[model samples]
Every structure is written in C-alpha cells, then in structure tokens.
Target: MPFYIRARTYFKYAEEQMSLAEKEKDPEKILKFTLEAAERAVRALWAIVQVEAPKEKPPLEKILAEIDKACEPDLAEEIKNHVRRIKELAQNPSVEAAKEALILSRQVVRRTREVLEPIIGPAKRVDQHRRFYF
Candidate 1:
C-alpha cells in the first residue's frame, strides 16, 4: 500500500489497540493490546518510507530497516528504541510495561504523522489521550 492508504490503515489500528489496552484490567491483556498498538504504529512508520516491515522477531530491526530502505534522512532513532521496549514488553507483560508501550507507540505514530502527512496528504487527528494503567 502507498503512504496515504497504508499509513492511515495502520495508524487507525494502532489507535484502536491503544484504546483497548487502556480499558483492559488484566495485565497480560493490557500488554497484548499495547504491543499491537506499538506494532501498528511502527507499520505506519514503515509506510512513511514506503518500506514493508519484516515479518519476524526483533521488531526493532523490523522498524529500523525503514530508515535505510528509503534512505530517508532524519529518521528518529527513538522510534526504533521504542520498538525495543515494545518487543521486551511482549516477553515480560506487566501493567507498567504496557503503560510504557502505550506512550512509546503514540510517539511513533505522532512522529510518523509528521513525515507521512506532508507526502501522502493530511493525517486525521486521532485521539491523544494517555492510556490509564491498571
């Protein structure tokens, strides 16, 4: 998919996952949704550079590859770092980890918007509420 459609698709999924995560009472379920949100946000970033995310372990590498694929300058390293946390959250699910994942996922989506919107058209404003943790 191209930037306009790809970014919008994944970004919307990310927001929805975050919403579910916030409402979850079980720590594992919270982590599950938070990880999905983060993964979808990273997918949106990949869309920005017109790169497909690698389907495998090491989500950080999956996200970071987009930086080189398009040779896009000014790719934020922090997004990759956040991906690391997201991957770790998968291994060790907890309320705190889910909260961190939620925050990091939002950052990835926000940063992706900064780049994606200008190239593909405007990104719709998604809700920016912080997910309340258990």
Candidate 2:
C-alpha cells in the first residue's frame, strides 16, 4: 500500500483503540494507541523523506525537527521584515526586494510542507496552507 494509505489505516486503528480505551477507562490501552499513532506518523514521514530528500541526510524525524526549529526564528524574522518591507515599499516600493522576499517565503512554505505532509495528511496540509496564506 502507499505510505499515505498505510498511515491512514494505522491512524484509524489507533483512533479506534483509543475510543475503546476511553470506554473501558484503561490507561494502558490509551498509551498503546497513542504510541501506535506516533509510530505510524513517524514511519509515514520517514517514507516520504526517503523519496523526497537526498541521501546522506539525517533520519527523517530528526531532520524535520531540526529544520523546523531552525526555521522558526527565520520565519519570524522574515515576517517582521516583510511587514517593514511592505510599509517601506508602500512609500518606496522596491520590486526587486519584494520579489526576493516572496521567493524566500515560498521556499519556507515548501520546506515546511515537505516536513509536514506525511505526518498530517491532506486535510491538515490544506489547513496549514490556509493558516499560512492568511
């Protein structure tokens, strides 16, 4: 099966297990289901990274986490700069800087999407897009 399908199946099973655990009030069952969900999500992302990234990179989750951490501050800085640039450009609009900023913003989005896709699936991917777009 495709990684996405497999991930979804595991997620379904985990959700069912969690529901059962809730009904039974069994803590162990809750832990089991939670672990299963995390494992399946990690596995799915690992598969995607295998396909999308070059070899010699770190493991998928580690790399993703590191990249995510690294990007957080940069993204914040970019947003701040963007606001300033937009205001400045409003007064003295520099097409070149705006274009460069736009390009960098796209790169951030693309990198984030690559890290997020297998973990969250399509609906969440769309949600992320919407969240970031606005």
Candidate 3:
C-alpha cells in the first residue's frame, strides 16, 4: 500500500480502537484497545516519516532531523516530542498514556499534512486537448 494510504488506514484503526476502549467497562480490555490504538497511531506516524524522508530506512532521529529541515522548527519539535511520547507510552501501555499518544499522533498527522501540502502540491488533472479522427 502507498505510504499515505497505509498511514490513513492505521490512523483510522487507531481512532476506532480508541473509541472501543472508551466504551468498554473492563480495565484490561480498555488497556488492550488503548494500546492497540497507540500502536496503530505510531505505525501511521512511521509511515509519514518514511514518506517525508526517504533515506534507505533511516533512523527515526535522522528522519525527524530531515523533517526539521524541511518544515518549521516548532512543528518539527512538536512532531519529535509526540513521537517520543508515543514511543514511551507504547512501552508502558496505559489508558492515560494511550490518550496522550492518540492526541500526539493526530497532531503529527495534521502537521505532516501541513508540511507535505506544499511539497506534494495539489493534484493535477490532465485534459486531452487533441481529438482523434478516423
């Protein structure tokens, strides 16, 4: 799958899982779903990083640095901080941690979109000007 598509899919899954977690009464199930959500969100961010910085599977830090150069410093820092928080929370896996991760992941996605909009630009629609006559 394309990076954007995969990232979007993962993010959607994360959102769904988060909703499920919220509705569930059991603590264990809530944790499980929350962790799943966090994992999906992290995966989505990874996809975004891969798309933004194509460097033969570079380390996350390197990718973040590349992103920093490509985008605004504050946005880059926010993304970095979110990635760090998500990683940390992924290790522990708690409801609060998951919520934090989800929020950060959403921010990362939004910021990534903002950064990529100019780089990717609007989609071009080609028009066929010539008519073939037989």
**Per-residue alpha-carbon lDDT of model 1 for 71-104, expressed as tens digits?**
2454556666777777787788777877777777
Q: Give stretches of model 3 more than 4 Å off.
A: 1-55, 119-134
lDDT at residue 130 of model 2 (Cα atoms): 75
* Per-model tally of clashing residue pairs: 0, 0, 0
Query: Please, what are the lDDT tens digits per residue for candidate 2 over residues 1-134?
Result: 45445444544453444344345333344334333333333333344434343445354346334332323556534433433443343343344543443343333333433545556455454777777543
71-119 per-residue lDDT for model 3 (tens digits): 5678667767776776666677666775665566556655554444444
lDDT of each: 0.69, 0.41, 0.60
Give lDDT: candidate 3, residue 27: 50
Clashing pairs in 1: none
True-structure RMSD, every candidate = 7.4, 17.2, 9.1
Ranking by TM-score: 1, 3, 2
Per-residue lDDT, model 2, residue 108, is 33
Output the number of the TM-score-best candidate: 1
